[model samples]
Target: MERWLGLARSLVIYHNPATVRAWRRFYGQILRPGDLVIDVGAHVGTRTRAMRRAGARVVALEPQALFARYLRLTLPRDIVLIEAAAGGAETVARMAVSSRHPTVSSLQAAFVDAAPAAPGFGHVRWDRTEEVRMVTLDGLIARHGVPAYVKIDVEGFEIEVLSGLSRPVPMLSVEYLPGFASLTTRVIARLEELGPYRFNPVVGERSGFLWPDWRDGAAAREWLAGLPADAASGDLFARLP
Candidate 1:
């Protein structure tokens, strides 16, 4: 019974109109017609729906068994929902999802380590562990098709997912937690290897701050490598070179 309640709480927390509108703009403005989209950490299909609404083919990859099931039920009939996580070549990994605040789920413990000192971290309680199936980017692309726009929000595992992609999809948006981003420095460096990545906080989520960029890929990597220890949410957009 408590599990059901927790699930319901997640649904309501995510289905806010402000978040919906922000995503609608992102998909409408960035995604193109006939574009294939890979949604890593699709959660309950909010972005999946927004992508479909923007006229794109979507592959919703989720690691949590229960969340994946919820996505299947919520996403459109046309979207392909995959019951696996996009990560390193392995086929499974342990995912830690918070019990009190399931929204702060992460693939790395560093999130929990950093959050205690962060604002609003006091209310979160991580009380669950689930080993889920894992899939790689190359495998997913070969199975469905190439994605032009890929949205990744895998908590701390975003770096692993990026590495699995053998080829650069046109545009990629990934959520980077500053606390974890330092730990995943390779991810910062690799995105730069793709050339000229731009980062901005999600519009409407906060006041939306646009960050500085490096003159070249190398500089960008260095800048990120030097980031402070504060944990904040930001999305990175890299146009493949």
Candidate 2:
């Protein structure tokens, strides 16, 4: 029952026509027809569908059983669906599950421990655990080939997900929480190690970049560090340019 409520909430928040259209426009600008894209933590498949509409071939990974089931039913047949989590290794991990707000459910223990004190998370709870299979980005790449874009939103596990990739793709994005700014900086450092990448932030669900031009990792870190603790959560987009 609680899981159903959470899924309903996510559908209402993300499946709306305006949000879907915004995502389609955003991906349309980045992807060419037949480009491959990987969506890590594809909860509810909103972005996956949007990328598909933009003419990209998509491979979506969702670890939550309920959400995976939902995606199987709703996502188009052409999009490849993987019912697992992306991590640094190909093993099993226990995921902290938030029955009422599954988007915040995560595999990182520290994130679960610290997020309650962060702004906009006091009401969220991880009341259950599920052992989920994990696959590395390199493994996915071996099977699906290199993607043109990879979108990751695994709560606080961004660093671990990037660790699995031995090489850089053309573009990728990871979620950032203002209160966890240091984690994002570490993510930037990881990206820098893989390739020379420029970054821009997209606050909340807005389809546009926050900067007039893509900035270096240092500039991106500086901007993230300057943000207030209560600032809106968003994705930090990185690309080779």
Candidate 3:
């Protein structure tokens, strides 16, 4: 019940009309009618909502029980909500849960341990844990067909999720924290192995990309490394050559 209430509060916080509009405009540029999108870490389905509004068919993945229940009650019928975490393989895993800010709950134990020292994470705590079934990106593709875009925001577990992917899709995005350069570095390396991919960054929840043009992984890595230690978190966009 406490977790449910926390999730309710998060829905109110994230469902801001102005912010949602910005995301909608950004997503609208990428998703076309009938395009399929995989929304990993679909917490409260805010991004899923934007994707649907942009005319994409969505597969919303949320592992937390409280949020998954909320998604089932609120998400559109056309959007398929999967109650599982996307990881490197099919298995059972433990998730660190933050009842106060459920969006930061993650499957990466190291990230949880390192959170206190990271900017913007000092106030949050992993107060508890829950067991969740884990599925892979490859497994998802096998079941739902390949998605045109996959938006991953599983806290710091982005690399693990990418590990499940054996091939590159047309495009994908993963959340990143400037304080956790190593995490994004590994994510970029994994993507590079699958294909020749260019990268861009969208700092925070803004509608704009950080660079005027897409850059190679090396350039992107340099850019990430140069960010100030206090730089806010954002999503990194990766696209195939």
Quick one: best lDDT, which candidate?
Answer: 2
Q: Pick the winner on TM-score between candidates 1 and 3.
A: 3
TM-score for each predicted model, relative to the true structure: 0.83, 0.99, 0.97
Q: Which portions of model 2 miss their true places by more than 4 Å? A: none
| Residue 43 C-alpha lDDT in model 3 | 89
Error of model 1, residue 76, in angstroms: 0.7
For candidate 1, lDDT tens digit of each residue in 1-241? 5456667787887766666666767677777878999988887677777788778898888777777778777777899988888887857778777755666777767776677776556677778787888889889888888888888887767778877876767777777656555644566577766555644444224423355431444544565566664645566556654
Candidate number that wins on TM-score, 1 or 2: 2
Between prediction 2 and prediction 3, which has the larger TM-score?
2
Candidate 1 — which residues are off by over 4 angstroms?
181-185, 194-232
After TM-score superposition, what is the CA distance of residue 88 in candidate 1 from its true location, in Å?
Answer: 0.7
Ranking by lDDT: 2, 3, 1
In TM-score terms, which candidate is top? 2
In model 3, what is the error at residue 12, expressed in angstroms? 2.8
Q: What is the lDDT of candidate 3?
A: 0.91
- Least accurate stretch of 10 residues (summed lDDT) in model 3? 11-20
* Per-residue C-alpha lDDT of model 2 across residues 1-241, encoded as one tens digit per residue: 9999999998988888888899999999989999999999999888999999999999999999999999999889999999999999999999999999999999999999999999999999999999999999999999999999999999999999999999989999999999999989999999999999999999999988998899999999999999999999999999999
1 or 3: which has the higher lDDT?
A: 3
Q: Which regions of candidate 3 deviate over 4 angstroms?
A: none
